[model samples]
Target: MGLIHLPTELILLILPPLSESDLAHLLRVHWSLYDIILPYLYRRHLQGSRDSTGNGRNEAKGFFRCIVTSNTAGVQRFLDFGADVNAVISAAEIRKANFRSTGFIPWHDTQTPLNIAASMGDDTLVSLLLNHGASVTGSRNHQDARRAVQPAAVDALLSNHESTLRLLLRRASPLSAPNMERGGLLNCAIARGNLPLLRMLVNEFGADLNATWQEGVYPLNRAVVSSGPEAAEIVRFMLDKGADAALANGGSSNSNGDEESTGGGSQRLLDQAIRHGTIDTLRLILGRGVVDPAIQPLDTGNNIFRTWIIERCTPETVHLLHEHGYFRALDSSQDDTLMIAVRARRGDILQLFINSGVVVDLNARLTRGGSTLLHAAVVRCKPVREAQAASSIRCTTMPSPVASSDVPTVRKIEPEYSREVLSRRCMSEKVEKCAPEEIVRCLVRGGADVNTKDARGISPLDLAEKGPEVVYRILVDSRCE
Candidate 1:
């Protein structure tokens, strides 16, 4: 027996690495080696107990530390000494170990050896203990890390040298849960706006896309708020991967799980994109068949930006919306794009619509009946007012009429009809819809009719009956009486 068959201790001292199983097998093979190495192993592990205070720390008897930091050979030789395999459970196991320290445990604050190792992201030590059936789920550092891995942990696993992620997954541990943080994985991606990670979780791990379905919301809704061009692409991926329009539609599904409304689910997504100024994401979503010329968002999707672009609009976004097939001229004339822009109050955007030759139907206004541009403008106004105001008048070149007053000059009547908006008013049910007298006065200045009755069939004066005499008096002074 040459050097190849040297004594076991000699073999371990000379060999570079030996596997844990080999060590365990070696222990069973030679009773003599166990006697010689056992005390040595005990002395080596004693160092791990220096910080531990109790008897568990004082016991200081384990084989776990010998193989803990070894590449392989030392582990086998140490195990041959009949070392306690699960030394990670003891303090004596910690000091002798070469793995990183797990942080302070939040629960009992008793930092276990495994806690020290795991927080350091040492995959080898983790593997060694896990192979020896070490407790993987015990409280280690903070409960956050002890119980679960957060984005930071995920980042560490993916970017760092640690292989714990694969280990956790291989062991089939829970990837995430709602209360942990950011509603767990899918929602975390949504909140962080990490499109690529979102794709991975959906396609690779099959994360629950509808985890927060109770709120009638989803990561896709959040995607609309994202600014990236690929944000829409991410949404499309989610839809293809089984994202439900019903799940994203708060207005569509009631608690009963039936379709309450139809057709503009994707349109709402696009409209929200416009509202948020997420043009890139908007283009990507519009590329889907949902916003095809054959199908339109109609009113809910009838964005004010489109209205403005139709009239005085032309911006990179408008051009992009057009190229992306958001709107069609429908003839040389019936373009609704500029109309959308005007209503959206892109007054600067209105210029784009006019230059592009978008036709403005004078009667086109917000559903409540202001000019279309004004309707869109009101909704787009920031720091919302009683009626957030935004408007632009659109007119075309009339064929230069023969220069003569006798030619029956046509006088275009400005819209002056005003309905009191009582949505924010403190008025009672009967008079609640009544517009404020001050707003009524502004409307009057803009040439609105003070006599217009709301659905309640009462004029502004009748609605003001409950107010101080000044309420009725304002309307009267404005000549609304």
Candidate 2:
């Protein structure tokens, strides 16, 4: 008699001890065996091999192994037998499977087989899974489902698996999901400068071209800050799709009650483009006619132009802004310009300002501290590495000095001035090629007052006491009284 004709109890008892491969052989032997054993195999697969604790499920381990091995037939068998397509790979299972090196993290503890396929850049497997109803929305948690789809889609795009990305986008589930942080799928595509996938998302998937993410940043804003030749094409595509080039986050809600801005957004976009040094993106934004070429968005506490100069952004980017008249939008106060350059330790930008015919008030005292640019530069000068090393050694050998009430406490400078100085120091870790001495000479040549003092009577020479000997020598040689 056929095994199928045997008592159900006999078949169930016999099947429990067989391996997955053995079951596959039996499945081929008869359709009756396939019907009886397939569901049983699926149930066992779902239950997984229990550990000593008998409480843990390693379903994801087998799934991960199947993916790593690219055993398409093995995977198909599991799916055909009704495996939970959306089951998550736990961090523990990932470790056990030796896939730790792949850097896969459980997305909300619900990373599906499809996410793994996408991340592995397996277009065929990804297609196969999607065809089998593998969800792009991995988990069913309504709140987390949307967030989960984003990372998976991003992985496919970042891996340059265009076919996989296209498959995910073709699914209605991913299309219906909300955008995640950093401007969601469209923004992610723009950030990677993937024009073809970007086009597919907009034209085929019907992705909302104007969707905003954290801080109400639009995809256009993200594109403006991204690097790559495809950036220009992506920007054009976004613009063609009726993206608002001037949309700004005014810290208010839109009609949809999502945090978004209808006005003043373009200026912020420009600032980001400058900050990231994307010259092509910058040109695209300016040429759109939404943002006035003359509008200068103040860097506020931190001058974006000064930041660009400090980071040594391409001269073309700086010159483009200057050529378009955006550079003139900076605060007209000469002291502000010079002090910004000095605080940034950007002698290059400072010189650029001078060469651009911008007036430099070398001896002008800051509004709050009453300290000249020279005083600020000297006080902010960090000691050389060798000096710091020697000082560290001396501290280990010398006894600690007790605090004395007789010692005068250094006066706290204005909050803005103190903040600017501290922020610059915290951001830059490496020493610059232009020494404090060179900066001092630059200021002196520009007619800075060598003896200029702040409101507390701290002169440039006095501030030099806190710096290296070279700084002090430069100040003293400049004839500080």
Candidate 3:
């Protein structure tokens, strides 16, 4: 029987229950049914419907599936059937819909079909969507629409879909389409580490290379903090485009319409770059020849060196900054760098400062406790078995001591090293061991005044009494007096 011969009421009843695939097959039964069922099929596919098994159709999922599978025909058909190309659900509505719990929603709230297509790197669908006037920036009323689309484009770029990202950018309205954080599109590119996207945004689209967004974070700072292979290239590009490397992060103006102080932000940029371990970025910033090496935070009262040392910077990073002449800018009298290193247990960093050709006053007392680095180190050093073993191994490997004119002074000694110590020492002689001796040696070699006392007049040697024997012996051998 011809499908057209069926009663309209009966056809409507029969069509509403059929799945999209089943309806597509029915199209072969009668070409005349195309006009009647085609719209219904498109609607079912786009809007999604529930079946006897409680399975339901989700408009967002249906759209995303079409894009991911490269189902261009399906996507086009939906758009042809009056699917709002820029349709979006607000984040609140999506949460209310409970789509997340049911696994019905595939895309984020405020994300349109174009956003989904772009994120999947489907250039074909993306082009199709744009050609159909799909808004690059989804619903204006939805505050997060721009935020949603920007990251989607960034995700496309991150997926190496340069063409799709370009297409999105060409349609992107810089005024409205921004990252979720309200960071500009350029910042998005920077955060994603997409050099191609970043270049295109700047060179082609005239994106502000140094535009500050989201709490006044600069694109340069974002790029520096990101772990991208082309980070250096991106930074150089921004610099060549007149990006201000010295412009501090969070460089927003005050309510008085005056340029807010740039001190803290610039200092923070250096600190963040160091913390992120982006040596190339650091070098690039330093190469700019504009950043103040002595930039310190006004609010926190921290200099770059103090921040770096207190943050326990890695040996390589410490060496990098030291080589860059950062140590000279530090106010050594305020808080000794060596004291900061000792407090953080960063022996390697301490050595870097010592070997950097900078005059380190090892006897300099910490501003807070008036304690020397040696005093801090000894007080913090715990008794580990490795130290005892290391001491015994050193004694065994050394030649027997020769008689000297300098007689050892008899001092009241604790009996903590009794028979247990003797037994462990005997066992340790057979094995090579490692301990914090390297730390002790570094301090002593730096001319750390072991006899220098804290505010309470407690000397490093006195502090060492509570520490391991290996540390005590090392201090004693160095001749504290």
Candidate 4:
């Protein structure tokens, strides 16, 4: 009798001793052999058993490969053969094997079959595994003692696998599970700027809009910093749905220390909105009237206008804040807006302030070192001045004359670049290099005292002498009397 004439019972007996590669080859041999071998092959490989060499891990990997490939029948067959629906695979093991199936496991977490399936965005496999008694609760990472259960729903949410998430949510109560454990799913959606997912989680699944999403953050705060076309839309949706605009970005009363006691943290929402959000988002938050834009809270450590917003925010954002009276509270302090503009080398912003009728008190000492505005301007321009001097020295022999209009001057500088910007920016472009000469001249023309000395008895001209020769000449001919 030929090998094809072998009985099914005999084939089953012979298959147990065969290697995986041989079984795979045999599976393609004949249709009759395929049915008999397929079940035995999956059953043998997916027994969910382990050994020292990680053969069981390879088996689990093969099973997950079927899930990723959308081989529903293969997955179903493995489950029928008594594979653990909640087979825990360490992220380390998956990583070591260099496993990738067109899509990655969302969290790189220790995961069950459902976690990987849900991340694949295949609701079919998710349903199949859930029916096979897969635990909807999260899997614990045994690799780390302090690591918490990484919820399967987070994997789906992070991947934007909405249908798969809906299936998992049906089997798992999102709130009771680890979905809301650390960084809540609602906040995750906000950070991703997925307004549809944000709406579904809140409207359908009851994810709290004002809930403490992260340790020290609320969803609205997350939405503010989350940049995308949908970011402002998400903020508006959250506020419209009753997210408390006045709730501190620092979360509950305990997070703000005494700010909640004195109603100080509420004022920072406008500041954060201006610093990080678009004009529309700023308008939305300002429209709430939760915090007064004109009133600078005394307890807030840093003034908003004095911060990097001049160098970081858009002209529109700066204008919106100005329209709301952000610069109205400027005082004779080191941290005033004009002094900050000089220190940051923001010629455009300085011009904007000057045109807006904001007084520039040039002789007033305005830096921590007790340097006047002129001293701050010259000191901050040192690096650029040195670089320019080196460039001029290198090109002196070749002295290529150019048209004045071709050069970027203070009058032509555009306000761009930021301190902690959300948009993509080239690091080569810096605020300090933008119209350094014009910044100095503007203060000088505004009657900056050339003879004014700082608390250290160091005058602006004295500081310029240590720098390149160009700085000294500029100060020597200062328009100031």
Question: Which candidate has the top score in lDDT?
Answer: 4
Ranked candidates (TM-score, high to low): 4, 3, 2, 1
As for model 2, its CA RMSD to the true structure in angstroms is 11.0
Distance from true location, Cα of 276 in model 3, Å: 3.2
Greater-TM-score candidate between 2 and 4: 4
lDDT of 2 by residue, 281-357 (tens): 67766677645554453333336555554455544555566666655533325226566667666676666655676
What would the per-residue lDDT of candidate 1 be over residues 1-481, giving only the tens digit for each residue? 7643577678657423545455455546667655544444444555444344522333232333333343344454444444333333323223334222322111111333333344445667556656665454433333223233232233223322235544544554344644334455465555444566676666667787666633656766765655443455666677777776554644366678765556533355555555552555555666664344445523224555444334432255566665655544422235455444433334444444344543333224324433333223222323223234322344557898687543111111111222332121111123111233333333334433445444445444454444445545655666634
Q: Summarize candidate 3's per-residue lDDT along 1-481 as a digit string, tens digits.
A: 7668997667878987777688888877776777778777777765553335533223455554565566899788878876666665444444554434533333344556766577567788888988888766544454324334434554455455678767776676442244442455566566656677777777777877656675456777776665455666787888788876556554556779655545454565665666552567767676665355555422124655464444444455566566666666333454456655665566666676777656447777765678776776776677777556777778455687986753222111111234433321101222221235567778888787778887888898898888888889889989844
Shift in Å, residue 138, candidate 4 = 2.2
Candidate maximizing TM-score: 4
Summed backbone clashes in each candidate are 49, 2, 1, 1
Model 1: how far residue 157 lies from native, Å:
6.4
TM-scores for all candidates? 0.42, 0.64, 0.69, 0.73
Off by over 4 Å in 2: 1-64, 99-109, 121-131, 142-155, 179-184, 227-233, 248-266, 277-280, 283-293, 297-320, 329-335, 360-433, 444-481
Which lDDT tens digits does candidate 4 get at residues 312-414? Answer: 6555556656666656544465246776677677777776766666564657765667777788777765666567777787844666897565212111111
Rank by lDDT, descending? 4, 2, 3, 1
**Stretches > 4 Å off in candidate 4:** 1-10, 24-35, 52-59, 95-105, 141-149, 175-182, 213-216, 249-266, 274-280, 294-316, 329-335, 360-432, 444-481
- Please give the CA lDDT of all the candidate structures: 0.44, 0.63, 0.61, 0.66
Error of 3 at 361 (Å): 3.8
